[model samples]
Target: MKDIEQYLRQNKPETPDEGQFIIETNARLSNVEGIKGTVDAERHRGRLMLVIALVAGLVIGCLFTLFVVFFPVPSIETELSAFSKAIVSLKEWEALLLVPVAACAIALGVFLMNRKKEVL
Candidate 1:
């Protein structure tokens, strides 16, 4: 590399601005290519992250929907009508109770699965 630099300096044409122009053009080209490569790498990384996040969200959404459909929490209604009095009543805090219970259930399942796999 040093030898190449020395040869270029010694054998470069005698035109006044030509060597300066060549050096500047090479510097600009280097900067442009570097910036383009950096941007492309960043774009690829962002796309991968977006795909992973989307997949995670979809899995969580599916699980939540299944939970709601299968393990329905009871609801309490105070409205009284001749047609409604026959319906059974449930406690008001049933939904709230299920929320924490489901959360703990999922956490426990995850913890047990990880433990079985020798993961923290």
Candidate 2:
């Protein structure tokens, strides 16, 4: 290894037209960077859309829950007694409903991520 190194040091290889090589390499790199920028911008837009959808869903869900909690149910005691009872029962287990809402949100996020990958 020492002998090989000594021989390589004695006869250093020179690349001809170094400036042209640098210019060509820089040009290629800039072209590749332009393509990368376009792809990155598209990805950013998709992510923004997904984030907006998620936030909107969250706001709607919160409003819906508040409405459910605060709004008075009309007198269904005579006509739709079973439906009224079911609603009352569901109110007791409203927290369990969040599991499904969270699952839906997670599913949507995963779907958006996968769809973005496909678009890319």
Candidate 3:
């Protein structure tokens, strides 16, 4: 063991010249930084798109709701056309349909926000 240790200590591994090593290291760092910048830009663009989509969805949903409330559908009668019946049924069940959808949207938003926080 002593002989092996003496041999190892006496013979050191050869290293590349300092300048070459520094240059290669700087090149690698710059490449990594470029990739980081691209990834950050993509993330920013994605977040912007998500915000736009959310705002558009909210605006359209509000406008539709307001239209529905202000212009109430006519009362259904025993004699009804297929389209009228379908519209009436949708109006009647709008709450049931929308509740789950709204919940999912809220959950998705929360999940995404949490994920962003975790990544940062």
Candidate 4:
């Protein structure tokens, strides 16, 4: 073991010149920085798109709710058709149904936003 160690020490490997080593290191660092910037930009774009979509959904939902409340269907049961009855039932339970759906959507969005991404 001592002989082998002595031989290895005596035959130490040669390193590249300082200038070439520095150039290669700088090239590698620049590549890494480019990748970092790209990843950051993509994350920013994704978050912006998510916010826009959320705002659009909320605006449309509020507008639809307003339209429903402002132009309610007539509640005359004497000549109620199947479609009209269905519409009435939907209108009556709209809040109950929409509340859970909206809650789930918000929860999903929050979970997605808070979750960590795994890299392969």
Best model number under TM-score? 3
**Residue pairs clashing, model 1:** none
Model 3's TM-score against the true structure: 0.58
lDDT of 4 by residue, 10-103 (tens): 9999975697788889999999999899778767766765676577667756766666556556665557876785578567768755764675
lDDT of each: 0.57, 0.71, 0.69, 0.68
* Candidate 4 ranges with C-alpha deviation above 4 Å: 77-86, 89-120
lDDT of 2 at 18: 83
> What is the Cα-based lDDT of residue 47 in candidate 3?
73
Q: Report the C-alpha lDDT of model 3 over 1-120, residue by residue, as the tens digit.
A: 999999998898997569778888999999999989977876776677577657756775666556555555557655787677658756776875575467557756765885575477
User: Between 1 and 2, whose lDDT is larger?
Assistant: 2
TM-score of each: 0.43, 0.56, 0.58, 0.54
What is the lDDT, from 0 to 100, of the residue 105 in candidate 3?
79
Residue-level lDDT of model 1, residues 1-120, one tens digit each, is 999999999998975758688889999999999988977766665555556555655665566555544544334234564234322222323454465556556655654554444321
- Candidate 4 deviation (Cα RMSD): 8.7
Error of 2 at 57 (Å): 0.8
What is the lDDT for 115 in model 3? 52
Q: Which stretches of model 3 miss by more than 4 angstroms? A: 77-120
Pairs that collide in candidate 4 are none
